[model samples]
Target: MKAIITVLGRDKPGIIFHVSEILYKVNANIVDLDQTVLEDKFFSMILVADIDEINCDYNDLKDKMDQLGKKINLQIKVQQEDIFNAMYSV
Candidate 1:
């Protein structure tokens, strides 16, 4: 299923490379990405990637990502695109 991974943290050189490398390693297809640095302390990135190739269950992916986030010192989250979109439905 399609999903979106959101990352936010301090802006630093190689932040994109580090994060995108992980995503690419996990076989995620990056469909879209938007990134920005606010001031000098906070930076954010929103990536929409297709993860239909993930072999395990969604829960497993979430756990792996939790570890990834902790490793990188960034707040990260993954959500099914439909669920995320529904949350904003009106």
Candidate 2:
């Protein structure tokens, strides 16, 4: 399945690396990624990751983000592409 993952939390070093590395380790291909920093917060949205072959299906992706959440107290969510699209339509 394909989707967009958003990470939002306090600004700090290595946040991108930490997140991206997990994606890489899971064999997810990042087709597009855009990130920015504003004040003391960091925000990122990533698209085009191929997670079909990933173990544990899509839940593994969630777990990876969850781990990061515990480590940095960040909010991370991975959504199905259709769900995300529908949300924007409303």
Candidate 3:
């Protein structure tokens, strides 16, 4: 399985490190990633992760990411690629 992970918040140090740490803990392999700052304050990232061998289920991973987001004062979300595509498809 694959998942789309998004993070958005004020730009800060260690954001990528913390996020990547969580993914690493779960053994989620990052396949693609794009991140940038907007107006010097908004930090946004989108990543495609291979979750085939992830240690936890989809919802569990999402929950963990959510908690991490809360701890870091960012907004983070994880969704299965298929569902994300379906929701955004025209």
Candidate 4:
């Protein structure tokens, strides 16, 4: 399965490293990523990952992402690709 992970918060140096680390631990392979700092202050990112080989279930990944976000002061969201697409489709 595929998933989309979105992150947003104040710009920081290790956001990508930290977020990717969590996914790595769960064996979620990053297929694509896009990030940018808005007005040189806020950080935003959208990452697409392949989760078919993840070591744990989706909830586990969400929990891990949530924990990391709390630790680093960011807003992180994880959604199955299908759900994400559905939510945005009109």
Best by TM-score: 4
Off by over 4 Å in 2: 40-48
Clash count list over all predictions: 0, 0, 0, 0
Alpha carbon lDDT of each predicted model: 0.80, 0.76, 0.92, 0.94
Which residue pairs does candidate 2 place in steric collision? Answer: none
Question: Whole-model lDDT for model 1 versus the true structure?
Answer: 0.80
State which candidate has the highest lDDT: 4
All candidates in order of lDDT, best leading: 4, 3, 1, 2
Cα lDDT of model 3 by residue, 1-90, tens digit:
789999999999999899899899999999999999999999999999999999987788998999999998999988789996788898
For residues 1-90, could you state the per-residue lDDT of candidate 4 as single tens digits? 899999999998999999999989999999999999999999999999999999998999999999999999999999889986788897
Model 4 residue 88 lDDT score:
81
Task: List candidate 1 segments past 4 Å from native.
Answer: none
lDDT of 1 by residue, 1-90 (tens): 787888898776776786677677777788999988898779899988888886667777677778878887888898889987788886
Question: In candidate 1, how many clashes are counted?
Answer: 0
Per-candidate Cα RMSD to the true structure, in Å, reads 1.8, 2.2, 1.5, 1.3
- Alpha carbon lDDT at 42, candidate 1: 91
User: What tens digits encode model 2's per-residue C-alpha lDDT throughout 11-87?
Assistant: 77887788788888888877777777776565554545767766556877788789887898878788778886787
